[model samples]
Target chain A: MLSYLINGISLGSVYAIIALGYTMVYGIAKMLNFAHGDVIMIGGYMAFCSSSYLGWPPIICVLFSIVVCTVLGIIIEKLAYKPLRAASSLAVLITAIGVSYFLQNAALLIWSSNPKAFPNLINLPSLQIGGTQISAVALITIAACIVIMIVLTLFTNKTKMGKAMRAVSEDKGAAQLMGINVNGTISLTFAIGSGLAAIAGVLLCTAYPTLMPTTGAMPGIKAFTAAVFGGIGSIPGAMIGGILLGIIEIFAKAYISTQLSDAIVFAVLIIVLIVKPTGLLGKKIAEKV
Target chain B: MSSILSVTDLNVHYGSIHALKGITFEVKEGEIVTLIGANGAGKSTTLNTISGLLKPTSGKVELLGESLMGCPAHKIVEKGMALCPEGRRVFSQLSVRENLEMGAYTRPSSEIEDSLSMVYEQFPRLKERSKQTAGTLSGGEQQMLAMGRALMSKPSLMMLDEPSMGLAPILVEQIFDIIKSLNKAGTTILLVEQNAQMALSIANRAYVLETGKIVISGTGEELLCDEAVRKAYLGG
Candidate 1:
C-alpha cells in the first residue's frame, strides 16, 4: 500500500506540473495548446543531447534543455498561432496537430527512433519510508513540482504581467485598451507554460531513464486529462485533479490488472464529467461577449 | 480646443457589410462629447474601429494630431486612448481590484497602487468589493469597475460605449453623474449612447448618427432641444 502511494505521488507530481501549463494556457488563450506535450519531448531530447552526448554537467543540461524548449515554444507560437490569430479555432487546432506531428517526426529524424538512456540521471538511491522503498528522485520530482506550482500561482495572482494575462483572458479588447501589449502577454504565457513542461520533461527522464520520439504522447494525454479532471481553466483544480488521478492509477495497478490502469483512470473521468461537467474546481461562467 | 481625435473618410467592414461608411468626426480635449444613434447606427463600430479592435477598410483615425492608421490595438492604447468597451467587459475571474490593476499593465509597476486608490475613490462600492470577483458584481458595479479599470491606464482620452446600457434607472443616473465627474477630473471622454437624453445632459457637445452617417452635430443643449432628436430619440 505504501509503495503504491509513493509511486502514485511521484507520477502525479509530474502530471500536476505539466497539467498546470495546460490549464494556464487554456485559461488565458482559450486554446487547448496541443503542442504543449511535444515541447516536453523536445526538452527530454535537449537534455540528452547536452548531458550525455556533450558530457555536460547534469544541472547545466537541465537548464539548457529548459531554455531550448522555451525558445521552441516561442517559435511555435510565432510560426503557427500568431499568424492564424484571426482564423477560426478549427484552423488553429489543425495547425497545432501539424506542429505536434512535425516535431515528433523531426525528433525521429534527429535523435533516431530508438530509446536513449541517461544512466547517471536515472540512478537515484532508494530510501525506506514507512517500510516502503521510495527513491530520492521521486521525492525530488514532487518537491520541484510543488515549488514550481507555488511560484506560478504567485506570479499569476501577485504580479503585473500576470494581471494582464487575466485581463486578456477576461476580455481581450478591454485589456488592449488598458495599454497591455496583448501579443507580448500571449508570448509570455507560452514561454512560462512551455518552460514548466521542459522542467517536467527533465524530471520525467530522470525517473524513466529512456527517451524516444513518442514518449510525450501518454504524459500529454494524461496531463490533459488531469487538467480537465480538475477544471479546464482553474489552476488549483488541475493540481488536485493530477494528484487524484495519480492515486487512482496507482491503486488500480495494485488492486487490479495493470492492463486496466488506463481504463480505470478514464472511467473515473467519465463519471466525474457526468456528475459535474466542469470538473471539481471549475466555476460555471455567465454568458457574455 | 484643437482636435484631439480626428476621423475622416473612415470606412469599416466585416466582410463587405460596410458598417461605417465614410464617416468623419473630431473630438477636442477637456470636453465631454456624446455620439448618439439608434441600434445598428454604427456607433459601437465607430468606437471599435477607433480603439483598433477593427481596422477601418479605408479612412484616417488620428490621435493627438498623429495618424492612428495601421496600428494594432495595443499600439493604439500606447498612444493614450483607453476604451471602456461596450457591455462592460470586466475580467470576471479576477477581483475588482485586480481588474483595475490590469488597466495599468503598460505603466510602471509601482504606479498600480496609486491608480487603484484613485479608482477606488471614484467608486467606493468598487473599493468595498475590491476583493470580490468581478463576475459576482451587479451590472452597475461592473460598469463602475470597467470605467475604473480604464482610468487605471491613465489614458489621456477615454472612449465609453453604451455606459447606460442595461442599468436600472437610478444606476443610470449615477453612471452619468460619474461620467460627468470623470470629465471634470480631467479625463477627456467620447461617449456613445442610445439614451440621448441622459447622454446629452452630461455631454459638452453631441453628434447624431444614422446608418453610418452623421446627421447632426451641435452643443449638447442645442441638440437636446432639437425637434427631430426629441421625437426620434428623447421620446418627446
Candidate 2:
C-alpha cells in the first residue's frame, strides 16, 4: 500500500509538470494549447537523440532537451498561435489541434514509427524506506517536482516578469497600459511551460524505459485531465489535481482491475465536475458591466 | 506654454460605427484638460485613441512634438504617458502592492522600491491594505488603487477616464481633491468625465464633445458660466 502511494506520487509528479504547462498557457493566453503534449514527445526524442546519437552525458542531454523544447515552444507560439491572437476562440482551438497533428506527423517522419529503448543514464541506487523498496529515480522525481513547484510559486509571486504575467492574465489592456509587453510575456509563458515539459519527458522515459513519436500522447491526455480536475487556470490546482489523479489511477488499477483503471480515473473527474463545475479552486469571473 | 499632447482631425471607427469623427484637441504642458460629454459622445474613444489602445482611422496624435502613430500601447507608456482606464480595472486577484508593482513594470528594478514607497505615502489607505487583494476593495478604494498604480509609472501626462463613476458623492469629492493635488504636483492631466460640473471646476481648460464633435472649447470658468453648457451638461 505504501509502495503504491509512493509510486503514484512519482508518476503524478510527471503529470503535474506537464499540467503546469497547459494551465499556464490557458491562464495567460486564454487559449487551450492542445499541442502541449506533443512538445513533451519532442523533448523526449531530443534527449534520446542526444544520449544515443551525440554520445553526450545525461546532464548535458537534459539541458540540451530543455533548451530545444523552450525554443520550439516559442517558435510554435510565434508561428501557430501569435497570428491568431485576435481571432475567435474556436479558430484558435482548431489551430492548436492542427499544431498537435503537425508535430506528431513531423516526429513520425523524422524518428519513424518504431519505438526506441531509452538508455538508463542516471545510475543512482535504490533505497529502502519503511519496509518498502523505493527506486532512487522515484525519490528524485518526487523531490524535483516539489522543488520545481516552490520555485514556480516564488517566481510568480516575487519576480517582476512573473507579476507582469499575472497582470496580463488578469487584464491584457490594463497590462499594456502599465507598460508590460503582452506578447513577450506570453512567449515567456510558453517557453517555461515547454521547458517543464522537457523535464517531465526525461523523468517519464526513465521510469517507463521506452521512447516513440507517440510516447507523450497518453500522459499528455492524463496531465490535461489533471489540469481540468484541479480547475484549469489555477497553478496550485494543477499540482493537486495531477497528484490526486495519479493516486487514483494507481489504486484503481491495483485494487479494482487494470482494464477498468482508465474508466475509474475518468469517473472521478465526472464526479468532481458534477459536484463543482469550476473544479476545486477556480473562481467564477464576473463580466465587467 | 507649449502643447504636450495634440490631436488633430482624429477619426476612429469601431467596425461600421464612427466613434470619433474628425475631433481635434490639445493639452498644454502642466495643465488639466477635461473633455466633458454625454454617453456615446466619443469621450472614452478619444482617450482610448490617445493612449494607443485604439488606432484612429485618419488623424494625428503627437506627444511633445513627436508623432504617436504606430506606437504600441506599452511603448506609449514607456514614453511617459499613463492611462487609468475607465471602470477601475484593477488586477483584482493581485494584492494592492502587487498591482502597484505592475504599474512600474517598465521602470528599472532599483527604482521600484522608491516608487512603491511614494505610492504608499500618497494613498495611506492603500498602505494599510497593501497585502489585501484588490478585488475585495470598495468601489472608491479600487478607484484610488487605479490612480495610485498609474502614479507608480511616474508619467508626465496621466490620462483619467471616469474616475468618479459609481462612487458616492463624498467619495467623488475626495477623488477630485486627489486629482487636483496630483495636477498641482506637476502631472499633466487629460480627464474625460460625464460629471461636467466637478470636471470643469478642477480643469484649467474644458472641451464639450457632442456626437464626435467639439461643440464648445473655453477656459474652465467660462464653460462653467456659459448658458448653453449649463443647460446641456451641468443639470441646472
Candidate 3:
C-alpha cells in the first residue's frame, strides 16, 4: 500500500508539473494551448537525442531540453497564437489543435513510431521504510516537484516580471498603460511554462522507462484534466488535482481492475465538475461592463 | 509656456463609424487641459488614440516636438506618460502593493521603494490595505488605487479619463483636490470628463468637444461663463 502511494505521488508530480504549464499559460494568456502536451514529447525527444547522439551528461541534457522547449514555446506563440490574439476563441482553439497535430506528425516523420528505452539516470537502490520499498527515482521526482513548486511560487510572488504577469492577466490594456511590455511578459510566461514541461518530460520518461512520439499525448490530456480537476487557473489546485487523480488511478488499478483505472479517473472528474463548476479553488469572476 | 502635447487633424474610426473626426488641441507645459463633452462626443476616443490604445486613422501627435506615431502603449508610457483609464480598471486579483508595483514597471528597481512611499503618502487607504486584494476595495478606494497606481510611474504628463465617475459627491470634491495638487507638483494633465462644472473649475484651459469636433477653447473661467457651454453641459 505504501509503495503504491509513493509511486502514485511520484507519477502525479510529473502530471502536476505539466498541468502547471497549461494552467499558467491559460491564466495569463487566456488560451487553452492545446499543443502544451506535445511540447513534453518534444522535450523528451530532445533529451534522448542529446544523451544518445551527443553523449551529453544528465545535467547538460536537462538544460538543453529546457532551452530548446523555451525557444520552441516562444516561436509557437509568435507564429501560432499571437496573430489570432484578437480573433475569436474558437478560431484560436482550432489553431491550437492544428499546432498539436502538426507537432505529432513532425515527430512521426523525424523519429518514426517505434518506442525507445530511456536511459536510466538514477541507479540507486530503493529505500526501505517500514518494510515498504520506494524507488530512488520516485523520491527524486517528488522532491523535485516540491522544490519546483516552491521556486515557482516565490518567483511569481517576489519578482517584478511576476507582478506584470498578474497585472496583464487582470487587464491587458491597463497593464500596457502601466508601462508593462505586455508582449514580452506573455513571451516570458510561455518560456517558463515550457521550461517546466521539459522537467516534467524528463521525470515522466524516467518513471515510465519508455519514449515514443505518442507517449506525451495521454499524459498531456491527463495533466490538462488534472488542471481542470483542480481549478483551471489555480496553481496549487493543479498540484492537488494531479496527486488525487494519480492516487485514485493507482487505487482503482490495484484494488479493482487495471482496465477501468482511466475510466474511473475520468468519472471522478465528471463528478467534480457537476459538484463545482469552477473546480475546487476557482472563484467566479463577474464580467465588467 | 511651451506646448507639451499637440494633436492635429486627428481622426479615428471604429469600423464604419467615425468616432473622432479632425479634432485638434494642445496642452502646454504646466497646464491642466480638460476635454468636456456629452456622452458619445468622442472624448474617451481622443485620449485612447493619444495614449496609443487606439489606432488613429489619420493624424499627427507630437510630444515635445517628437511624433508619437506607431509607438506602442507601453513605449508611450515609458516616455513619461500615463493614463488613468475610465471606470477604474485595477488589477483585482493582486494586492494593493503589487498593483502599485506594476505601475512602476518601467522604472528602475532601485527607485521602486521611493515610488511606493510617494503613492502611499498620497493615498493612506491604499497603504492600510497594501497587502489586501484590490478587488475587495470599495469603489471610491479602487478609484484612489487606480490614480495612485498611475502616479507610481511618476509620469511628467498624466491623462485622466472621467476620474469623478461613480463616486459620491464628497469623494468627487476630494478627487478634484488631488488633481489640483498633482498639477501643483509639476505633472501636466489632460482630463476628459462629462462633469463639466468640476472639470472646468480645475482645468487651466478647457475645450468643448461636440460630435468629435472642438467647438470652443479657452481658459477655465472663460468656459464657465460661456452661455452655450453653461446651458449645454452644466445643468443650466
Please, what is the TM-score per model? Answer: 0.96, 0.97, 0.98
lDDT of 3: 0.91
For model 1 chain B, the run of ten residues with the poorest summed lDDT: B100-109
Q: Which is the better candidate, 2 or 3, if ranked by DockQ?
A: 3
Candidate 2, residues A1-289, lDDT tens digits: the string is 9999998999999999999999999999999998999999998999999999999999999999999999999999999999999999999999999999999999999999999998786779999988999998988889988998999999998988888999999999999999999999999999999999999999999999888888888899899999999999899988999999889999998999999998998899999999999987777864333
Q: Residue A34 in model 3: shift from native, Å?
A: 0.9
- In model 2 chain B, where is the ten-residue run with the lowest total lDDT? B114-123
| Model number with the top DockQ | 3
Clashing pairs in 1: none
Candidate 3 lDDT by residue in tens digits, A130-230 = 99889999999999889988988888888888778888888999999998888998899899999999989888998897899888889999999999999
Alpha-carbon shift of residue A122 in model 1 (angstroms): 5.9
**1 or 3, greater by lDDT:** 3
Which prediction has the highest lDDT against the true structure?
A: 2
Tell me the deviation in Å of residue B12 in model 3: 1.0
In model 2, the clashing pairs are: none
Tens-place lDDT digits, model 1, residues A35-82: 788899999998888887798888888899999988888899998899
